[model samples]
Target: MNLEAIRAIYKFEMNRTFRTPLQSIIAPVISTSLYFVVFGAAIGSRITEIEGVSYGAFIVPGLIMMMILTQSVSNGSFGIYFPKFTGTIYELLSAPVSYFEVVLGYVGAAATKSMILGILVLLTAGFFVPLRIEHPVFMALFLVLTALTFSLVGFIIGILAKGMEQLQTVPLLVIMPLTFLGGTFYSINVLPEIWQTISLANPVLYLVSGFRWSFYGISDVDVSVSLVMIGIFLAACIGVVGWIFRTGYRLKS
Candidate 1:
């Protein structure tokens, strides 16, 4: 394996983030803070508690999950897309690097950034409301898996995208909505019977549910189920990425 190649790519991506701390780090923290302000003030006043946790605290895991998911995708997609957009990807392809090495660099950096943001957001949330982690081990597992899985999804997106519009569209149009609808602001159990059934079909629900369960020991589904759902999705994303590299789907063109 080309450890140097992976290290080079990883350092480049991480350096980019450090160079633009305002956009990469501060912006996300601020955006998440706004969610707490708007949701905590507007909704928390009325709802009070959900499953014995204060509304403000209850939403912490969801908010962190949302941030992790969106940022992972955005970072991974842009890390690769910029290379393609600038026509530098061919240079990368010509380099002494394997496809898996290339992926490790971009996806690893993205996941690292997302985890930082997730932890920072969690800390910031602690300032607003009481917090606890009944299952710290599982919480860490969910965080790492969610970041890596979504980062892979973003890698695939970056390769497939033809332009900036397409690169930005999927996260805005698809991922954001799914996160919101996936037990973020409210639990799916509160929904009507049919809506609950429909909500179960959303993959993001499992991510949020499992993370929330780790925090408060409550979730819409079993923790094992959440683990299974995430594992399946992670495997599927890995398979898709492997296929993309094997065929050179959009990268070769």
Candidate 2:
């Protein structure tokens, strides 16, 4: 399985993170903390609870999901993109490593970083609001699955990107808006009936709903539907990655 090859790549990517702790770790943590401060203070004053959960507590899952999605994409995309940018990818390609091993290394490392950040944000939330997990196991499952799925998506974006601008395009233009509008700070049920239906089409809603369900046993969407959506996305990403490797799409160029 080329375990050593996978480990080497994983360690290299991870070391890059450690080398830029301010940009890679501290910056996101600070940004999320600001969300808690602004939203928790401003909105909490007006809306005390949503579905019997405090305004501050209600947003935790969504915020964590938001961070996980963005960071997973960022980490995964940059990890592979840097090598491509510097023309080092050819060396890795020439190594005695299989495509699966290469993907496992990059995506696995990205997911690990996202998970760590998610946990840190979760813990950081405790200081801002009272928190509880009705189903800890399911919460962890959602966390891991969301991280892994988006990490794979990021890997695809990395391979497809032609420049730094293209690499940042999806996460900024697409993901961020979907997340903010996807019931992050407020419940979709509060929206107009039409908007609520529209919100259902945004995939981030399912992730936030399912994660919130795991925490408070309340959700805007069915937990099963959320799980199914995540599985579908995961499978789609794996398919794309497999096709990329087989065709040597950008890698061989």
Candidate 3:
């Protein structure tokens, strides 16, 4: 795409996010803070160390992962949904912008928002616990990759959704359950051997484990496996999203 087209799409997507400052910023930060308080402060004191890190510290990566995944998904879902709802997407669809350009613009902005929220939550957690990063580069990589993966998922859902209600349902019913079951609050090692094997099926577990590895220099699952899983998820989402947009799946109808 030309620079002009790229600029237009980027600005449009960014403006949509900034338009609702509270929903985009304060809401996720506050909700995550509450998790830090309830789980990190209240429960952490009673639980002691988890895998050599303080319970409070152990949950920090999980909390950040949670915020990134949710916000990225929400941002991406809404980015496309609002235009479709307001009858403005026809302008976008007919414009000079390619589907690839459109995807990059929306996904880029969503990733930015996710990273911002991730950093904000990490900072907030620092106030309550002594936060440390075992691998800064790996931590950053996990954050970006996970955000992109979820943003693509959100894009698919946004295109499929018929109304505002459907937008909320996907995250509430699907994403939330996966996150909670994904070793967000505790280590998978704490589970029964059978349960541990089953929790391995959760996609979120790989994300959380990769993020945790970045924090404590250790992981319940191999960092390589987590990275591979994330890579595969990203690749799958990209392929599916490209197919959806290429066919104009729900967007054109």
Candidate 4:
């Protein structure tokens, strides 16, 4: 409802990205390129194809998902955390802005950044491997949903963090491990039956599977299930954020 307030916050957060183009934009792009070089060249040579798609092409969705998850969390967490760290959160709190507007500002900026990075990596991937997108609409849908979901996750982490070390804890320790194990570079079907079942427990699997399905029409999990899983996760994040705002958890402290 408070469009002007949301826009101001959104612009402020987005402006930070422009200010640190090297860190905000270039670094993630370069890092993803390295993954393509290493995995696509060294590992891809030995493993030829997975599910009839070239090894290099197979990992594109997973790699992009990995980057989007990490960046979404990193950007979202840092965006709000900096305001908390600098003691400016109180000023924002005092403003006439609604909680929804504040969230839209910070999470919107983070998702926008992650989406841009996702598109850039997708384009960059073209140079490494021949690519085909069977369902462009589905691919874009997955991309936007993944970015928004993780951005919200990052927003929660930002509000809950007590310090810089705590800020980096979940993404490094939890998210990264889940992503690597989430059928990123290889299909889970190749795993032992037991491990394949265990892989299902990891939420990132659904994300990668669904996104990869958008590309090749193949997946480790059903695309419908993946959509449901993402919806649940997104809802959970929104619930947590709502609770945080209502309770004034860390924000009021």
lDDT of each: 0.94, 0.93, 0.88, 0.94
Candidate 1 segments exceeding 4 Å error: none
Give stretches of model 4 more than 4 Å off. Answer: none
lDDT of 1 by residue, 49-121 (tens): 8979889888899999999999999999999999999988887999999899999999999999999999999
What TM-score does candidate 1 reach? 0.98
Off by over 4 Å in 3: none
lDDT of 4 by residue, 93-172 (tens): 99999999999999999999999999999999999998899989999999999999999999999999999999999999
TM-scores for all candidates?
A: 0.98, 0.98, 0.97, 0.98
Q: What is the lDDT of residue 62 in candidate 4?
A: 94
Which 10 consecutive residues of model 4 have the lowest summed lDDT?
42-51
lDDT of 1 at 245: 89
Q: How well does model 1 score by local distance difference test? A: 0.94
Task: Tell me the TM-score of model 3.
Answer: 0.97
Model 2 compared with the native: what TM-score?
0.98
